[model samples]
Target: MSGFSIVNGIAEITDPAIYENWLDNEEFKAAVAADSSPERNAVKRLLIDFEADLARMVRDDRVQEQVVEVMTKYAAWDYVQHDPNAAGNGLEKLIEHFRNVPVVGEVSPPVVSVILDGEVACLMMRKPVPDPVVPDTTYEWNILTVFRVHNGKLAEHWSTFRKAVPGRDPLGD
Candidate 1:
């Protein structure tokens, strides 16, 4: 069995081997379902809505202003530090980065998980890389984002990404 359990009303995924196996394991799935308290539900909903907005932006090539509207005025987007165009910083710069850059293909919806402890929520998701810029070659990426939500809006965000080697899968298998 996957070493997933609950203690003091918090879901604990003890086994690193089963970290990515929760989606398929019935026990883990049931545990996640049972731990969906009201606060967690709200954070989940917020992430879903944010993803929908991002998808819409990718599909239409237009910025959805309402998505940022829900964010705090001083929302700290840790992901943009790697973006060259975000030199000015802040949400507007991030929006400009998205607007100026060209998206070759659709953005796939990420697999999201949320963990809530008291007033803090940790949201984790895996997103696929966009299509390659070069022809006849494919380079894939797996991006994981963890967001800290406060007051029902995104307060802080952090992300890490891994690129698949050419002619190999993300895991280099």
Candidate 2:
């Protein structure tokens, strides 16, 4: 249980209790303190809104509203494609893939690790899950999200996903 402090993009959580304390501290209250820029607050609100929407998704096993809004927000944006034509690249296509699945299992809570360099932030997350078709098939995969945030708005983003294979124990060799 940890989170981005965002003051300088430093994330620190020594204990589960620390994160619990943070939940009660209500960091959003701190975000609302400075009243000079309403627009900045709006972006902050958007971040919170997305976070809340993600929570709802966890409960519902869908990302409909959030996906639509995010796609609209990124309209006319440049996207780097690993394989643009194959499956997912555009927001609609991404949403389609997830929606197309007969049973959309809840995505695991992202294990977030951030790399901060100046104003840029890269969040490396590992989200593992059992293959829906075969419950016994489980694997932990990596998803990296790079965000360029300026003035508190998500100006740009890049993301990629990877998976790992399991190896048999040495005694079998």
lDDT of 2: 0.42
Q: State how far residue 150 of model 2 sits from its true place (Å).
A: 8.3
Distance from true position, residue 140, model 2, in Å?
A: 14
Tens-place lDDT per residue, model 1, 61-82, is 5544533543333245532333
Tens digits of lDDT, candidate 2, 1-173: 23433344333333434322332344532432223456544444444344334434534655554555644453223333342222445555644533432323333333234455654555544434566777788564554556555555455555553322222211111
RMSD of each: 9.9, 9.5
What local distance difference test score does each model get? Answer: 0.48, 0.42
Cα deviation at 26, candidate 2, in Å, is: 4.3
Q: Pick the candidate with the highest TM-score.
A: 1
